[model samples]
Target chain A: MKATILYEGKHQWTVFGRDPDKPEKIIDTNQYLVSTPSRALLIDPGGIEIFSSMLAATLHHVSVDQITDLFASHQDPDIISSLGLWDQVLPNARLHSPWLWESFIRHFGLNNIEYVPLPDDGGTIDLGDLSLQLVPAHYLHSSGNFNIYDPQAKILFSGDVGAALEADGAPMFVDDFDEHIPKMKMFHQRWMPSNRAKNDWVSRVRRLDVDILAPQHGRLYRGADVKRFLDWFEALEVGVGV
Target chain B: MARIKDERLAEGEVLVSVTVIAAELSEVMKIAKEISIGAKNAKAIAARAGDKARGFQPITNFIDDMARHTLTMVRQIDQEALSVSRICSQEIRTNDAKRRMHDVIRRVEHPSLLKSFQGVVTDIDARLIALRREFDKRLDHLAELLDSINSDMRAATAISSSCRVEASRAEEFREGLGVVADNLEQAVEVIKKHVKECSSRLQHAQRLKQAIYKK
Candidate 1:
């Protein structure tokens, strides 16, 4: 599978289930398009107003019908409020998420799309040549949360855990871990307060040989810095998490 | 009879005039002495009364010492007055020596002849003037001293009054302590009575047990 990184400022998206070079950051949504030889997948496709222009730009190269599956990591407004909008744009796309967050999404009045309950334990969903593994991040910040890890690309799409509040202009790769670690530390302390959850996450990541750690909020971290962050995260006092 | 008649006539006329004049001078001197003695006596009485007031011992001591010194001064002034009176009377009685003395006194008293005797008279007059000035100054000083003493007495009286007030407060405090002591004693007595009653009850219980065992 081929990968193309589409970034707007510090925000980045890895396009694997769709055509490369279509990076979208509209209004409040950050969209990642992953395409295989036959089908395509869009993870956390932002709100309608935000991704509309970028979608237009993306469709210029590939058709909207190419999108076969849509994955929302959690049920927050900024994360999956655009699910209905994505359903309208790609009617055949299946909404894959944890079963726990299905009712939460129904609360948003999105009914037409098929809600595929991803397993609580780690499981894989075939997307042509690449497979998306649903890694459980239960109680990291929310009760029903998971992340997609593509072993083919060695990329882990961490939902919110390693995320920072970096602006769009920040470095896309993990080369600037010194500057980004403080932001990540602050975000973790505020959002992820449980030491047990943090340790569980660190152990999960340590098992995966990740080349890229892309979070929903910040720039992607790559290489040994990813391991360093995991080690640092595991060693931090639990109290500091909150 | 002629000699007795002559002696009586002289004694009744010239001698009587001289004696009356001397008596008048003596009366003046006596009045001066009385004034001085009255002032000295007043000081002594105040000193003695002040000394007897045990609370004002410092003030009394000071007044006693001042009174003794003042008595000595009054005595000296009385002596001086007596000397002046004696000189005036002695001069009056020596009628035979008067003509010769009058010649010397006339020269001394005469302002023109006094020029020759200027040093002596001037010295005497200056001394008298100085004495009068000193007396005036001393009177003013005494008045000021008395005023200061009065003010000090008023201050002492105020202080003594405050001390009395403080003493009353201390008495009240002591009375409060007495009440506390009485309450404590009452509590102790109550505790002792309870202990005695408990002891008697225990003894009665022991006797009842003995009777029951005997039965």
Candidate 2:
């Protein structure tokens, strides 16, 4: 139940999961928390299986009342199936997600929450003083997905865009980018149906001043590795399944 | 009867039962606090009554020390309640995970996904039994704490009765110290009553805890 702080002071960001409470058979997921003094947001809060562990972990950082918003990149269970439990805790909290997933994600339970739908082109989530930008990331894997960008922190929460499926009890960050290719190659090729979407996303992110490229699954890409990830993804072929 | 579909213990029942036990323990804390106050008052009365209450002086210190011990034990019991709450919450999670396996088994069509689901369910079943065993061990620890508190009260009672008898030797001074001994006896009786009641309530909570170990 440790929330490892990525950035402290001013606007803070933390990465949670990869602990004993998370079972071995289940795929590893990285849950993010970005907070200022008055407001906080939970990114891809994870499935029902780890809800208590997540809540207990988050409480160590901030109380339930401080959580102002929840961000779901798209409607995937590993992404946000704990919405039902979250709804119980943060009944008045706003859920920020793509408009395409408004109806589909309701199946994860949205009775009390105010669903703030993001446009197809993506939009900004205002946390009072600090504003978070949602970068459009359609068909990287999910048909209508988006990525969270914190300009001040220079971190891009790339959703499933630069994801890798490391085995359970694996490293939190990429130690060897080239060696990690075999882990992510087949997953991307089969999951990302359109080669056009993959290239478009890679090209768009290259223009942004990103210091950290974080994803929902597997290790983060930091410093020069961010550029390395773009180069690899741009050259790789996806959706052929072969 | 078709075995009553939801025979499994509900989480809310465990929560409410724990809440009641915590409240009963609070009563014991309150009585311990009163006993401390009585000891302070008796010590003052002992000094004024002079040699007639000479034997009573040491016994007042005993009462004060016992009261302090009781308060410390109650704090430990509060910790026990917290441990029970944590274990109960874990049980709820195990139950939820088990139910989810059944859902996955029903809906997932892919052979790989279905096989994975089966593995998860098997893992969760083992986890549920382990959680119950852990819960039982915590309850046993809680029972030991209650027994320790009872032992402290009995020692305090033996000291208290000796002081009650000392109040009879005052002769001319007996007229004034009579009220003091009566107040001390009443405080002792109050402590005994609440401690006995709280011990029983804790045992009831422990039984309810035992009932929840069902598969």
Candidate 3:
């Protein structure tokens, strides 16, 4: 599956599926575009205030009716607050999220879409050549947390774990581990309190052989920086100096 | 011996003459007038003494009672003072805890940049609410204790004042007794001196009569 990376405003990265016979798909913090041979999926459409403009701009070349799925990682405002708005735009779309966070979602009062329950262990959802695996990140931050890993691209879409802050219009990819470590350390110290969960997450990610680490908040990491982050995360778990 | 008897008879005659002169109507009238004046002076002195004693007794008693009660009240005041001090210390401790809880709530409500995630907001809010409720309960308990203690202090103060007044009155009454005793002692000494002079005169007259009879 061919993919076109779109730089959605507000420091978000959207990977759009670029096949002629399929609709588009987006990912991460903002609107994402994923296209199969006959249908498409939009993951984590943002807040309702910006959804319409973002949808119009991002899907300028693609039709909204072709979008088939609206998937959310959890029930946080930044992640699934826009699902209600997306439900109005895409009538035929099914909303997929972990069952643990369903009650939290109902707070938004959205009722038109289907709520698909993802298993605890995780499973793969195939759209022709593109297969997205739902990796459980439970207890890392929230009970219903999960990460999406695209096997074909060797890209792990981390929800908040590997997130970092960047200036507006900054590069999306991490060019240096030395510069990123401070931001990552700050994030881990403030957000992730449980060392056991951090170690577990590190072990899980080490086995994946990920080439690209895409998080919702920060820049993506490629090559040795990803491995270095895992090592540092593991050291944090073991009470070793980084 | 005859000369001695004659001299003794002369002394006896003088003694008899003096006695007869005192027994005369005019002399008796004069003695009666002197006696009446003396009795009138004694009565006047006695009346003054009685007035002084009556005035002094209640004052002395009041002073003595006041002193005793004041002493007891002073002791109680010391105890209540200690209690007040203890209550103040406890109230300060409770207030400190309340301030610390407020600080904790403020800290949780506005977490650091790392916890700026959307999900952490809900957790912080819930925790802050719980902390605030706990702080409120503690403060309410402290306030109630303070109110009760304050009322107790006021009652203790009133009792302390009454005890002090009683103690003062007791001391005054005790001093009055000393003054009355001193005045009574002076009056008794004056009466004793007059009776001694009268007995000496009667003894002289008896000696003269014995000489005259022998002559």
Best by DockQ: 2
Estimate how well candidate 2 is docked, as a DockQ score: 0.01
User: Considering summed lDDT, which 10 consecutive residues are worst modelled in model 3 chain B?
Assistant: B20-29
Candidate 3 residue-wise lDDT, B1-215, digit = tens? 12344643455443443233222223222322333343344333334456443433343333334333333433343343334333333333233333333333343323342132223234434543554354335334433432442343344334334433433444434343343334333322332333233234334433543453354
Candidate 1 — number of clashing residue pairs? 9
Please write out the lDDT profile of model 2 over residues A40-89, one tens digit for every residue.
Answer: 99999998777766765665566556888999999999999988767655
By TM-score, the candidates rank as 2, 1, 3
Q: Please list the residue runs of candidate 1 whose C-alpha ends up more than 4 Å from where it truly belongs after superposition.
A: A1-30, A238-242, B1-215
lDDT by residue (B75-147, candidate 2, tens digit) is 8887887787777776775577566445444443344434323444566688678888887787777778777
In order, the Cα lDDT scores of the candidates are 0.52, 0.77, 0.51
Candidate 1 residue pairs in backbone clash: A9-A168, A10-A168, A16-A34, A16-A35, A17-A34, A17-A35, A18-A34, A18-A35, A26-A50
**Greater-lDDT candidate between 1 and 2:** 2
Q: lDDT per residue, candidate 1, B1-215, as tens digits?
A: 11233322332332233223323333333433343343344334434544332333343343334334433433443343344333323322222122222333342323443233224234334433454344334333433432332343344344434333432334424333233223323332332343233234323323332332233
Residue B65 local lDDT, model 3? 41
Poorest stretch of ten by lDDT in candidate 2 chain B: B1-10
What is the lDDT, from 0 to 100, of the residue B124 in candidate 2?
67
The share of true interface contacts that also appear in candidate 1 amounts to 0.00
Candidate 3 versus the native: TM-score?
0.46
